[model samples]
Target: MDYEFGMLAWSMAGHDKDKLYVIIKTEGEYVYLSDGRLKPVERPKKKKWKHIQVRKTIPEELCSLTEETIKNEEIRKVIRRFSNV
Candidate 1:
């Protein structure tokens, strides 16, 4: 059940914490929040055709790093806590 997903990170609107997104591969080349499909840049003269890339969301529950959720903390904590060996 291993699949690749994109890491789309941004600040949540009106919220202090960073927001991460995860979307199914089948959804393909789309931002979870944006209505338009995520397309790669191409020259104006060339026809647009390429592999679709997508932004995947990471669950919110796993977002906290420190013993308590500290404001404006470095992401190093989160990385150390959850990163693969």
Candidate 2:
């Protein structure tokens, strides 16, 4: 899977399994994820790509985020919107 910034994914192997997160950064086979609550944008969880299941839904708000922009609240809102569905 080709990981890009702002992509929504779910942790599949760790204690956070089934929890939603947004891809903040990607390095090789590892991707940094943030839930915007437990794991804020300032401190992302680095997990292997194989451990995350990419979601088809990509929030529109994600497109506005950049490496310099930190929008933890938006990330949290997007996750809440999808997880409820």
Candidate 3:
């Protein structure tokens, strides 16, 4: 299944038909800078982010599937060995 990610910037209401909640830096990790350490807060009822940006997607080749496959194979081998022991 295809999954998507976005930052919930703010909540808005009673706007034009084309506008709704503001979602920013969608679909990938984005570098966000804050003046101080920010923690999760209650959802605001206003539109804080006016910028709609798309984040860069990393190439799948960099995340080598070979390592994961090897790990899974090793796990299966260990499970089979213990099962027969």
The best candidate by lDDT is 2
Question: Which candidate has the top score in TM-score?
Answer: 2
Error of 2 at 79 (Å): 0.5
Question: Per-residue lDDT of 21-82 in model 3, one digit per residue for the tens?
Answer: 21211233322211111211122122223332222332232234321232323323332343
Better of 1 and 3 by TM-score: 1
Clashing pairs in 3: none
lDDT for each candidate structure: 0.27, 0.87, 0.25
Evaluated against the true structure, the overall lDDT of model 1 is 0.27
Off by over 4 Å in 3: 1-70
lDDT of 1 at 45: 14
Which has the higher lDDT value, candidate number 2 or candidate number 3?
Answer: 2
Distance (Å) between predicted and true CA of 82, model 1? 2.8
> Which run of 10 residues does model 2 get worst, by summed lDDT?
56-65
The alpha-carbon deviation from the true structure for residue 33 of candidate 2, after best TM-score superposition, in angstroms, is 0.2
For 24-49, candidate 1 gives per-residue lDDT tens digits of 22233322221112211111111111
